[model samples]
Target: MSKKILITDDALFMRVTLKNILVANGYEVVGEATNGQEAVDKYDAHQPDLVLMDITMPIMDGITATRTIKGKHPAANVVMCTAMGQKNMVIEAIQAGAKDFIVKPFQPERVLESIKKLIG
Candidate 1:
């Protein structure tokens, strides 16, 4: 069966782009969240195999959401997808239980590579 994925980003464009990429690559997109809070909530509803999360969002940031999800579901897989590439941010995301970090404006291959490593 195709793996289910949840995409979380405040930007509609980012969500759309990610959805397209995942769908075209034979993965299922189970949910989309406009913010971190929604991401956490949808995760419970969807029980996706992975979450593509963005940092620097209104409401709650991706790191916090990742941490929350990890706390609740220790086996949850989260990958940070953001424009922020700072060392500190990457470290924080890793500490928050993100399995991988991909800087925004990313190549489709890079995104798929990360997801594949986790769920494929």
Candidate 2:
């Protein structure tokens, strides 16, 4: 079965792009969120196999959401999405229990590789 994935990004374009990439690569996008709080709620609702979460967002940030999700589901697979130069936040995201990260302007191959590494 295709792995179910949740995508979270404040930008609609980013979410669409990532969804396209995941869908094309044989992953199922189960849910999407524009902020970290919604990401967490969706995560709980869907219990997807993976989450691709943007580091910066309104309402809540990725690191906090990652931490919250990890606290509840220690085995949750999360991959942080970050823009160029957010090194500190990236590191914090890893510490918060994200399994890996993908930098934006996403390359489709990279996105697939990250998801495959975690879910496959």
Candidate 3:
């Protein structure tokens, strides 16, 4: 069976782009969340194999969401996606238990590489 994935981003365009990429690569997108809180909720409902999360979202940020999800499900697989490639953010994300990080305006290959490394 195809691996289930949950996508979380505030921007509609980003979510669509990610969905297209993931779908084309044969990953099943089980849920999409517009913010970190929604991502948390969807994660519980879907229990997806992976979560693609964005930072700087309203309601909650990706780092907080990743931390929350990881706190609840220790084995949950989360990858941080954001335009901010700042050192602090990356460090915080990794400390929050994100398995990998992908910067925005990403290459499809890079995204796939990160996902494949974690889930495949």
Candidate 4:
């Protein structure tokens, strides 16, 4: 079965773009969120196979949400999405239990590779 994924980004365009990539690559987008808090809520509700989360967002940041979710579900698979030049935040995110990360200006191949690496 296709892996279920939850995509969280502050920008609607980013979410749409990521969704398109996942759908085209044979994955199912179970839900979407515009911020970290919503990501956590949707995560709990959907219990998706993986979460593609942005590092910066309103309400809460991805690192905090990642930590919260992992605290509750140690097996949760979270991949942080960041822009270039946010290495420190990316490190923090990984420490918060993110499995991996994808830098923005999204690349379909890299996204798929990351997802496959995690889900497979």
After superposition, which runs of candidate 1 have C-alpha atoms over 4 Å from their true positions? none
How many residue pairs clash (N, CA or C atoms closer than 3 angstroms) in each of the candidate models, in the order given?
0, 0, 0, 0
Name the lDDT value of residue 104 in candidate 1.
Answer: 86
| Comparison by lDDT, 3 against 4, better one | 4
Give a tens-digit lDDT track for model 4, residues 1-120. 999999999999999999999999889999999999999999999999999999999999999999999999999999999999999999999999999999999999999999999996
State TM-scores per candidate: 0.97, 0.98, 0.97, 0.98
Pick by lDDT: which candidate is best? 4
Residue-level lDDT of model 3, residues 1-120, one tens digit each, is: 999999999999999999999999999999999999999999999999999999789999999999999999999999999786566887899999999989898779999999999999
Please state the error at residue 14 of candidate 4 in Å. Answer: 0.4
The deviation in Å at residue 35 for candidate 2 is 0.6
For residues 7-89, what per-residue lDDT tens digits would candidate 2 score against the true structure?
Answer: 99999999999999888888899999999999999999999999999999999999999999999899999999999999999
Q: What is the C-alpha lDDT of each candidate?
A: 0.93, 0.95, 0.94, 0.96
Candidate 3: residue 31 lDDT (0-100): 96
lDDT of 1 by residue, 2-120 (tens): 99999999999999999998999999999999899999999999999999999889999999999999999999999998685466887899999999988888689999999999999
- Clash count for candidate 1 is 0
Instruction: Give residue 3's lDDT in candidate 1 (0 to 100).
Output: 98
**True-structure lDDT of candidate 3:** 0.94
